[model samples]
Target chain A: MGRRKVTHQLISDNATRRVTFRKRKDGLLKKIYELTVLCGLPACAIIYSEYKDGPELWPNLNEVRSILNRLSELPVEKQTKYMMDQKDLMNKMIQDAEKKLEKEKMHTRAMKLGLMAGSNDLITDTDCSEELARAADVVDKKLKAIRERIKAVEAGAPIIKRD
Target chain B: MQSSNVTDCTMRKRGTKRKIEIEKRMTKQQRSVACSKRRPTLFSKAADLCLLSGANIAVFVTSPDENSDVVYSFSGYSHASEIVDCYLNNKSPPKTTINPESAKFWWEEPDLYRDCDDLSELRIIEDRLMRTKKHLMDYLEKKEKSHSVSKSDQNPNNDSGSSSSSSQIASDFGQNPSTLSPSSLKIVSFDQNSYSSLEPSSQVTTCFDQNPVFSVGSESSSDQSRYLVNEDSGFVDGLLCETEEENNGMRLPQETQTQPMFTEEDQSFWENLDVDDVFGLFKDDNNLEVPLQDHSSTNEDDELLIDISEYLSEEAMECPCFS
Candidate 1:
């Protein structure tokens, strides 16, 4: 009967997840309604659930569209500026990822080099040494590919969708 | 027997109250159900806030699945859009950052920029077309009004119906098929600038060649000119003025002046669009007009009555066919 606090993560169990979503969604809507009523502010909410046929909008669809239409009237330069800011953040993330990947690659390379120099301390089983080397090669290739993708995204290039 | 078994079943209850972890992946159905249930509660809260404080607030949410959005407004006697317009009007140079809470939910998220691009493109075209029509109506109305003082002088039926329909068709045709060409983009760009400066109007002929879609390098340029026409003709100003008068014992002439200038028909058209169909907004322009009598006057709400009469008179003034 005790109510224990849980983390705000997605629930994994099917039944629990469904129940949690329902309870939390209701709580959120209640908060929104209270904010409007107590503050007398003009507020709207659009909730789209995957299971629903269409999005569940608060108040009405017409009102939301009208607000969106007004928001969209913002000058093109302003919107473009917002996009540019996003691009900048993306580029920064890519750079950080690249640095992390470089450090990892060097560490892996050193281990392979040490193994080749007959440093048996790093490898427990002598029989699978070749396999270990091959696995490291595959990892290196995957990292390289990921870096390339990061570059492409930074350049505003269209990403090729993988089927 | 059930009480004795409680110790053995501790695991069942413990599992239900397990500690929360980091963001975990959720099933599509779970996510959907969560959104659906939470959405209504938010609106009810908004409604309550409006009634208690007499403050205007708008909440907008865009669903990830259907790419649809919902808005809740505590506008009281005023339409939601008018409240937003007043907000925007009061803050002309909107900050570079929009709503902080909603920013993450914006359709233009970096990964989803393509969809956002198409939508803004459509909005630009729609905004341009609205302004053009407004100007055309203005010119035609002025000419008609000057030529004859009496409403009986003009051809009411054919002109009102045809002009609106023809303009809609003309804009639709002009944008879609020839969107690739640069010449059309150039004309629209020119009009966009001139429109901002309050030039009398753009040449209607320039509209025939203008396109909404842009080529790669021109995104920044097009984005700069994407100033949407303010849909509010100052209805909020009038209402706000009324509010201020009750509180301050003095009248605000400036705000009152702007509302009546828009003419009743234009106000009705705008309001109806906000109140009516979403998908039908762009397509069905003609049939949406409800009879004037349909409006509520039961509470003897003088303000509502005045608004209705303004619309009726504007409709009469525009169409000679109507008695």
Candidate 2:
């Protein structure tokens, strides 16, 4: 059976959270092992939890110290070459999303102008086609309202407002 | 009949959907089993990342046992100390080590063909090969055009129109040998008082109205009475002999002689050339591997090579009849 989509939130129950943590912690350690072995690079992780007596160290304390020492020996510029903190990662993600949004907005504006000019050429894109369908629905509603108004005037009865 | 009934029951169980309560707490034994089973898969993925991107990584995880203080640690290197120390000293949060512009995550890199499936990997390789071939072809064509221009320039008797056209072609390639223009060719008298500023080894001075051509003597002579011609094979021979004599009678360097005078074989080679031949040349020369290893470094090297090639082509333009 296929798994359901996981909710991105912490488990409220203490027992369940502890269980999840153990499982995830093991998975994280395994990943670190694979990375170090496959890439032949220095890497170390330290994890702390209430369940454990002390913070867990991958590959032992000696290896972690060696990796850290090597990294510390490098110049500050070299050390930071590919480094990004949580804030930096978030900023980068935000910037990329904003750029994409701006591009999408421009595309939508162009599509709207094309529709207004009564040209179907811009309908080539799926997004443009969807937008066209929406515009057509609005136009249909407006036409129906106008038709109702005209009928009311011809019948000389009270005209109900429709939007 | 009993065996058939048992088989039917098994089939019914297999066909039933089992909804997992993802948020519910699992039993202690189930949790342990899950951790054990998932750990190997996680490690395998990390290994793949390390192998593909050459990135250093370290991970530490605390054990779930309530009384245990043991923290599991894994490192990409022999010891995780190097990475840990770097992190501690730098006080920077961990981020991806690969170029961010190329890929936010190492796994996202398209160039890591190892991660791609067979068809896509093949397509990437083919695309790279095609681009390399195109670049090689362009370089060869440029070299040929420059060679032809240099050849035309060697004939001093050629009309101004031909010289100008050759110059135009040379200019198109951004390599105009301005000093060696045919229109600027003139034989000026070698006056010791005026030419005394020239190098002591430059015994023969050939001057045009604009540019001066200085020729070193065959021997240590103070004589400035030798007349330098501005026309034909004689001038070329004098220049070559003067240059060769300076190098202890060694022929011009192989690099300067790269653009050989057009021959029937060369013409045929150009005619028969195709993508396969270019690809073969790349393979034979081992030029294809450099770009694959480090694209940025290779790009810088390629630019430098282009500059050197242009300089050499200009030198060739100045003395086309070296052979």
Candidate 3:
């Protein structure tokens, strides 16, 4: 029988959750063991549950201690060189997204200039050109209003401002 | 074809299998069996991930049995304790010395050092090219000045005196005027100070007199004929060979003797030189604003010469990174 796709969510029933946890725990331990063997790098995981009296150790207690000792021996700078937590990962992702947005904005500006110069080949997306045209119309309207205000001031007339 | 047929058979078998809900409540026996079977498959997946990405991972899981006190732990090649410790340490705030705002993962940092090294190497090559160009310009200027002086000296009364005198000298040397190519002529004793102090016409005459083989009245007509006979083979080669033989064991340095003297390659180097290419090297430098198309004014040429000299004398000598 083919296994049905399971939605990613917490199991609500206690019995079902326990069963699922047991299956997943075994699977996770096996995966970690395989990863250690294949990558030749030290990795360790600790899982806490209300059902367990003590956490299980992979390989054994002695190997885990030795690996921790090796990690501790490294200088703090070297240890932290590649280290990142949830917050750091999130911050990095946000920074990357912002940089991408800035690049896209610059590209859009260049495309708008190309459009104004009457080049159609620069139009990669119809929506982008439409948005740019709307923005251009808004800017043109603002410019006309500013020009009218300047002429009113030159003619020594009191101008009422409207938005 | 056989592999395709096997794949088709597997696909047919897969299609025939009934879908079972993985999330449905399972009996205790069924759950135990599923856990046992899935363990190896999960391990294989982890092994594949480790092999592909070189990631260090460790996972620990508690026993699901209410009576069981066992907590299982799994680690990659390294000890699980190390990864756990690293993870714990990473969970804490980083040191104050390290700016949190600028902190990036090792992979995120750009390889600026390699780019810097490339830029430095390019600067070295550009500097060398500029020095070579300056030397070539100085040589051509000296040659032009000497040629004009020689012409004026030869023809004080007539405009065609240089042509006539050259022909006379060529006849005296028993060679065609065209055969005495300017590129073949090597300056033996000329220096900047000597060139400035001595008259160009006198210096030109003295060059021939300085050589024993070419001393007009000193050598017999027959001896001159013998030297001229060898000259028919190659003017520069004959002169060098005769000089070496006459010097009686005096030999020039290997580099001096083997060094190429104004070959076609060198001629092409000058011909193919582009001012734009030289300027392009400094295009990214904000402090330097080289006028791309302006080379017509003598003042600009002088300024460029000064800039090249400054680069060669000051910057090149004191560039600590390259040194």
Best by lDDT: 2
Interface RMSD of 3: 14.4
List runs of model 3 lying over 4 Å from the truth: A1-11, A80-163, B1-323
Q: lDDT of each prediction vs. the true structure?
A: 0.45, 0.49, 0.48
Rank order by TM-score, top first? 2, 3, 1
Docking quality tier of model 3 = incorrect
lDDT (Cα) of model 2: 0.49
Which candidate should be chosen as best, given TM-score against the real structure? 2
Over 4 Å off, model 1: A76-163, B1-323
- Reported per model, the fraction of native interface contacts reproduced equals 0.09, 0.09, 0.09
| Model 1: docking quality category | incorrect
What TM-score does candidate 2 get on C-alpha atoms? Answer: 0.25
Sort by lDDT, top down from the best = 2, 3, 1
Relative to the unseen true structure, what is the Cα RMSD of model 1? 35.9
- Writing each residue's lDDT as its tens digit, candidate 3 over A18-120 gives 7766666666666555434433334455443435544445677776666555545656664454344323434655797899999998888776766755764
True A-B contacts kept by model 2: 0.09
Measured with C-alpha atoms, the lDDT of residue B239 in candidate 3 is 36
Model 2, range B216-319, lDDT digits (tens) per residue?
33322323232323333123222211222222221112111111234455556556557677534644544332232222444423332334355466568678
Q: What C-alpha lDDT, on a 0 to 100 scale, does residue B291 get in candidate 3?
A: 32
Clashes of each: 35, 36, 8
